[model samples]
Target: MKRLVGLFAALLLLVGGLASPAQAAGTLNWTAGDSITAYTSAPTTATPGATTIVFENSAATGNTTGMPHTLTFDTSTEGYNHDVSLNILANPFDANNGRHEATVTLTPGRYRYFCSIPGHSTMVGEFVVTDGPGPDPDTTPPTVTAAAAGTQDANGNYVGTATVTVTATDNTGGSGVDKVEYALDSGAFQAYTAPVAVSTAGAHTVRYRATDKSGNASTEGSLAFTVVEPAPEEDTTPPTVNHALAGTQDDDGNYVGSATATLTATDDDSGVDRIEYSLDGGAYTAYTAPVVVSTAGMHMLHYRATDKAGNTSAEKMAHFTVVPAEEPDTTPPTVVAEVDGEQNENDAYVGRATVTVTANDTESEVASIQYALDSGAWLAYTQPVVITGLGAHTVRARATDTAGNTSPEKTVTFTVVGTGSDACEVPDTRTTVVIDGDDTGVPNADTGDGCTINDLIDEYASYPNHAAFVRHVETVTAALVAGGTLTKRQQGTIVRAAARSDIGS
Candidate 1:
């Protein structure tokens, strides 16, 4: 009997040594009432190892049949694990008030603890398992980076298509990166799965962020960039053309002699590539310098310009005429005379006479007109010329053209009779005096009688001084008759014979 008792004591000591301490597992306490389900003090975080959960029922203490309740643990909400469920507690006021205890091995993860009994699922809580002994909390958020490959212009604007890539990283290795999201132009955030393509024009904004598996989110990061339209598909506008010239122009826009037609072309988008021109509706040719148009008469020129982008300008045309040099004038002027007076049968004026001369020319205007009386110096003729002489008078006129050509002299004759006795006096004439018989000495004698005088005048009436010469001849003839040299009839016959002869007086 002593040996058996000694053996039992030794066995008791060994069992006590094998049992674990009450504080070895984390304590999670829960309670249930008449119709309510809740937890007194449940642990939110536990070390990676064994965890203890204590449940108590107190419905019977309230004077009503206690409802049975159960505690369960699961990897996800509403996914209860039958193996981790605690035995049901039915008695409310029994010893220890239906108290129960459960222990479970926990790894590093998040878990859900709730009652699996009908109508008790509402009582739930969260459970987190971590490394042993005051493990560090996941406070560091994830970092996100965004990059793009696109062309940049001088203004820092992105041109053409761009590929945008986003990446996320976490420093906490326990809960790595969860997900990365991005937003464009304040739009809604979307999960970033692949590279994004940006192909629009103008400015834009991008926002990105990342989250860690431990529910830690990073601050949003922003990036600004501009997208410009692709270089305008080959310039399509044509070049402009300008033309200039240096020379004298006529009323018809015509230039005389040689002249240069200068052409200039300009383009706004693309530089001018070439210039072409055509003359008189002829074939087109490239132009390098000013064109020389030396031909006379009307001319038509067609020109155009093209840009480097293969754009051609509308055809432009210009018209001009050229004149030749002037020639010299060689035509002489014509002169016309006008007389203002009454004329006799022999073209002798009975009263005062006025004469006017007019000159005209075809090629050049008349320069001057000159007039002269018989045997008188020439004078410029501004107005009409008046002739007041009492005998036959002569007038001469001539004209000169602007080209220095002088016309032949033109002459006209007119006569004026005065209202006096001297006006009847015969004009001076040339005649001879003769005697019928020889008279040695003849003193002053009576001239021939009136009948002899009349015969002498009638014989030499056509002579200029016939009347004067006739009187002298009569006197000489009478001297001879008085000296007994000739008879009266003979004297008259001798005077008439002298007037008929061409002898000196």
Candidate 2:
């Protein structure tokens, strides 16, 4: 009975030793090729025991590119096991024929593993180790979705480059996601960290996938996009500038009182940014409205413009002159009035007459011109004034200048007469007379009654007074001379005889 108890105690001690974690040894394999993003194959789960890490990157192991690879366990990051210390570098050209191995005792936790190569950050993965038994093994793969981003054109094509972003999510109670990878345009898969930028200008496709720590991979997700060239360089051309001068001007090309200068600027590509101007030789100022140059002198309006692209136009200028306001007009205007008519033999106008008035000013423009007929009230004169009464009449004219100065009055006078067949009658005293170019040798007065000078004076020389009788005698003599009834000498002798006889005096 003492021997049996001793043997049982020994067996119990042996079983307790075997029950400790990391008693058994586990062999894990990792492989890589010419790719820098990830290893071709990797183990995701292991039992808590002495782990033998085997990494290969040789020709026989499909590493035809002869690129180097490493299997290194991370000890710095959180949320992962840090007890294991394993690092193995292998390549086809190395002495070990691209095969390397390391031994590490692993705890019952998660271990983060990756390639230590500088550009192989995406070659990261996670492996879980359990003592003997744990919860149900995680078998569900992580969900992965990809999206394309950049500035897009109207047709959804990227302007310069297209960026691809991949996101992944693992199922609840499942092994955490290991790594995200993407294949650009059907090329080799590369590990994803930041957004992947594709600059080639053409149609492209990115296939993405995510793997969990349980070695389950999600269904491949693809993103399609088109990259286009970027927009042309910014506009380097400056804006065009011009100006217009507007106002009343004199014949000498000088502005009256004030001149208005308006500026305009245009740019076909970037559009105008701003327009600036300087009056005369003053400082430049932003041009918002028309600049009124009221100061009297020769002036130069300088103007220029700038574009949004920082382009500045050459300065341009317009030259003009403004006349000063004139002094007040103290001198009045000058007016002239005149009458026009036809006169009879007695120095009397035959019928009507016309009166004309004119005005002039030296310092100011004529504002109004007025005229009055006889003693009538003054009225504005637009045309010549007419007088139809058969009598004497007068016209007066005046004018006012733009300076409110009235001119002195001016006047003109004229007389008019009536016309009739018997206005002046005369008696004939001759033995013979010429009527309508025919000679009648007989007495012309009282139906062939011969009359002498004495009869001429006594028969028709009666009048209200001496003046009337004298006028009749003179008229009879004048008619006799015109009709050829008597010679000029005889008519004079007859008139003298009538004067000597003195019928009325």
Candidate 3:
């Protein structure tokens, strides 16, 4: 028995020695959420090798709106590496739960990446991959140096302020410098990306160091400088601010359509810091753009400006009159309702019905649309209404104009015939609940896939998280209520039951 055990252990060791080693994967992570203009974090430099790319944009990462963003490598742009084809669309609701990864081999070059979504032209960056580690190891550290720049006074002290800049250089045939760090007055060291500015009226010391990609760190270097306060100037004059109104005027000196007011301020000694304006004696607010007044009446706009020297200009007023357009809009909006779906031989919809309400007003324009399903209470309509229950349905819709005129109601009727297998009966699970003011069968879960309540709830296990599952339940229940499949009370009961379940959680 001992001989047999020794022989087995030797065989195991031989097998382990002969096995192939796993490939080294270099990981590069990126994040973008709640922003349309730029990525929250991105990689600027990487080493050439088998790279694992990761991109994430999710609710936990700060995307509350569930907006999608794409990270697409530029293949058509000139002067960029196109070796790897990568395009990833990420959002909180995507299939991969807003995180995606891919494996690719990277070469030494500059790769350009950007968001392909329209109106996101500012989201662009470059990834530079350096050459792989050479056969000859690099052991030489990088050399760091620091310098100060400022106007010197008679006492050799800098005038007003001093700027300190650091530079690092690697030895010949060595790994490139990775990062530079600096410390102020023996404080904690921080990654240095820009010049350091010191304005205090005293002597200061800046210590800096650099590290190379090969883990070689250079010796710390230091730079000392002194700053002296500059003489102050006296200017008590306030800034001058003026306003001008621009618009087409009628024969009676009344502006037609609208009037735009522009405020201009100038200060010779101290520059203007801010400008504020008030319309119709209202609260003063910061002025950012030209204010346009289109109301059909006379108006007064007040404006003032403040300078950096603590001087404020007196409030000035501009008077103007704006008349309405030639034609008045007193007509109500025209509305129509239509039912659309896949119809069977009897003209009844197959499983579901869709109702669309449209309203148009060329004069004042439609301001809102309201719809009532099956003589129920009116609800604000933002999208097409979908109905799904085996029964006849009626949708009544109306529109309101910007002038507050309501249009006459328009009605559309439709029938929904189920496939006889879409819905299944599930037992009530909750011990105490109320639906439509009745306690009987209070928490029954309806299914369209012929599954039990638990089975149906477990279907959301494939989602990103429990919050996403809850959101889907809310969305589906709201639609069911709109379609008359479930009453508002029943929908609330079902949603509450789902939320209290531990299936997705």
Error of 3 at 381 (Å): 1.6
Better of 2 and 3 by TM-score: 2
Lowest-scoring 10 consecutive residues by lDDT in candidate 1?
10-19
Highest TM-score: give the candidate number. 2
Can you give the lDDT of residue 72 in candidate 1? Answer: 54
lDDT of 2 by residue, 1-505 (tens): 3343233223211111122234438788888888899889987778886666677887877787667777777888998987766666677766577776556677788889898768889998887787775457777889999888899999999999888889999966467788999999979998989899999999999999999877889899888989998886789999999999999898899998999998999999888999999987899999999999988989998999999888999999999999986678998999988777787887776645667788999999899999776555577787665553445666788999999999988888777554553322443545544322333343444311233333333434345655445444554444344445556676555555545554566
Task: Identify the superior model by TM-score, candidate 1 or candidate 2.
Answer: 2
**Where does candidate 1 stray beyond 4 Å?**
1-239, 244-262, 266-275, 286-298, 306-313, 320-329, 338-353, 363-383, 389-505
Better of 2 and 3 by lDDT: 3
Shift of residue 249 alpha carbon in model 1, Å:
6.9
Deviation of model 1 at 431, angstroms: 39
Reference-based TM-score of each model: 0.28, 0.32, 0.29
Better of 1 and 2 by lDDT: 2
RMSD of 2: 34.0
**Candidate 3 TM-score versus the reference:** 0.29
- Candidate 3: pairs in clash: none
C-alpha RMSD (angstroms) for model 1: 39.6
- Once model 3 is optimally superposed onto the true structure by TM-score, how far is the C-alpha of residue 186 displaced, in angstroms? 90
